[model samples]
Target: MLGVAGVVVAGAAAIGHLGGSDSASPTVAPASAAPVDENGVPILSLPEPDPVEEPQDTAGKCRADRGDQKSGAGVIAAFNFAYYNQRNGEAARALATPTSTVQPGPELQRFIDAVPLGTNHCQKITALSDGVYLVDLSVMRPGQPVDRGTQTVTTAHLDGRWYVDAFT
Candidate 1:
């Protein structure tokens, strides 16, 4: 598992340098404020910010929740779908950050290439930290026994989306 994580980090570094130094970062819209008239009257018809960043005493809100469990689950699901089910390396890579230092391009490609084509199912997902999750997975190939594994996946909230940063 640690070896695979290393490959992913290497792959990310590789992806980052693929286009040289000219790669442009994606733009994200800032959280918006409510509209008001010159006299401070509320314009109730306007759309409001989603308030995803509001502080909360409970476990659901804060900077920690910016890359929430739901997003982590989705990314892990998509990664599994692309890696095991569809065998689409490009799609799997898309779900990951391109600038990770631990997973460079060659290692990442090797990792992707080594993934066995099979059916993958998420058995359980546990949020271990704010932007990280522990995913229990079941993988089975035709005429083979089911294999179970657990991976700790880390994510980052960048450009308004959660990106897989590393996993082990």
Candidate 2:
């Protein structure tokens, strides 16, 4: 009886091995043959990446001459020209007062790094007070729209020179 049972088990195993088309087996399609939706669009398809813009070389683009430091607007113009157009932190800092927010440190370096490559132009300057003014500035970059903004610049007349006391 045991020999008969062993023969039956062996015969069942042989039958399963011969039948290779098992319904329980999982199927994987190649990448090129990805599954499609009802609309015939590939389900695994990804959108094309956006084109990356290269950084513009802004060195030597700014004028070597500084703005007239005698007026509050002039000092502000000089500061903006140095910081944004020239990317010169030291030149910008030179126009700032001793206790001004524009100081030499990581913060200054961060400002230099964050300056966009463009031409910084002083559009208009309106005197708010004796040594304070509202400056309308615009930045122009190649193949881009002009960016316009306003900032308040406070100047101090110390040691017979106008220096940027605060900028906001």
Candidate 3:
């Protein structure tokens, strides 16, 4: 009877040794608590997307050459073509003065917003002075009658280039 009891004790010890050690078990990380509102509803927070930068020049090449910039009528033609036809504000701004309203800002945004749904064509350019001109514009808006009006455009010669000084 004593020998049988010793054999039983040895067998139990062998089984316990085969169970596994603490290091053999996989470690599990504790879950973090999510953010909640007053009613315990989870609140989601996302990061803002980055802004896209527009190129200074486009494939159409709306910028006026030196000879065109030398003439007020030419400059106005190029500016109107770029601003009203192509809807290229940057290209139009290149033909404007540094302090002109066509610069990239709220003033420029207003012009961009006011662009017609269809197209604008320069009809006639009458020289008011050596550096100024009266431009006759034909505006065509979608689902609207064609409208014709005249605007005063002033030009300035700077650094061997002519820039639109003021437009009204």
What TM-score, over all chains together, does every model reach? 0.51, 0.55, 0.53
Off by over 4 Å in 2: 1-65
Candidate RMSDs in Å, in order, are: 23.6, 20.5, 20.4
> Of 2 and 3, which scores higher on TM-score?
2
Candidate 2 accuracy as lDDT: 0.71
- The lDDT per prediction is 0.62, 0.71, 0.68
Candidate 1: regions farther than 4 A off = 1-70, 101-118
**lDDT score at residue 52, model 2, on the 0-100 scale:** 90
- lDDT comparison, 2 vs 3, better candidate: 2
Q: How close is candidate 3 to the true structure, as a TM-score?
A: 0.53
lDDT of 1: 0.62
Query: For candidate 1, lDDT tens digit of each residue in 55-164?
Result: 43332211211123237655666666666665666666777888643355455567767766544444465779887877776766566787878778888777877777
**Ten contiguous residues with the weakest lDDT in model 3:** 58-67
Better of 1 and 2 by TM-score: 2
Query: Ten consecutive residues with minimal summed lDDT in candidate 1?
Result: 60-69
Identify the candidate with maximal TM-score: 2
